[model samples]
Target: MEKIKISKDEVTHVAHLARLEFGEAETEKFTAQLNGILRYMDKLNEVDTNGVEPVTHAIARKNAFREDAVNASLPPEASLANAPESRGGCFLVPKVIE
Candidate 1:
């Protein structure tokens, strides 16, 4: 017989922490499913990964983005062109906080 990885009480506790409501049948089902997943992970641990390089993505891809370039800064006049109210060199707005 295989040893169970997660118990019913532990599943119930986890459900409570997640604010989830479940019946006895649902709890039992979740316990079995979680145990199955853990057992598969345990099986995966048996594989020897001595000299394998970890990869971020499964497929190769090119950088589909434009190169960054330096640009001239916008003048105060151009920046405040569309402003409803500009005081000195900035936009003026109603007071939000007291």
Candidate 2:
């Protein structure tokens, strides 16, 4: 793998852009991590994918949707049977947000 260099100034600039204040130890750690990721990406770039067809997903999957058919509806009382509290066929809940 090609050795990718990350300068302190670059790390500092990135930190500033991200609104992050990093100590010396954190800066060095992040610099190493970023370089390592770049090196890995470079290694991936070397891969040959000449004949392979690009696809959204690795596995072939189709949308399995059931036939849309109107059916008999449940009664309001039966539907609201498990509700903790109900008023005039509506659920009662504490008010949220101002």
Candidate 2 displacement at residue 16 in angstroms: 0.9
The prediction achieving the highest TM-score against the true structure is 1
Q: lDDT of each structure?
A: 0.90, 0.85
List, residue by residue over 13-36, the lDDT tens digit for candidate 1.
989999997899999899999998
Off by over 4 Å in 1: 47-98
lDDT of 2 at 76: 95
The backbone clash count of each candidate, in order, is: 0, 0
* Candidate 2 ranges with C-alpha deviation above 4 Å: 47-98
Candidate 2 local lDDT, 1-98, one digit each (tens): 65666777899998899999899999899898999877777776678998988898788779967789988899999988999998999988878877
Clash pairs for candidate 2: none
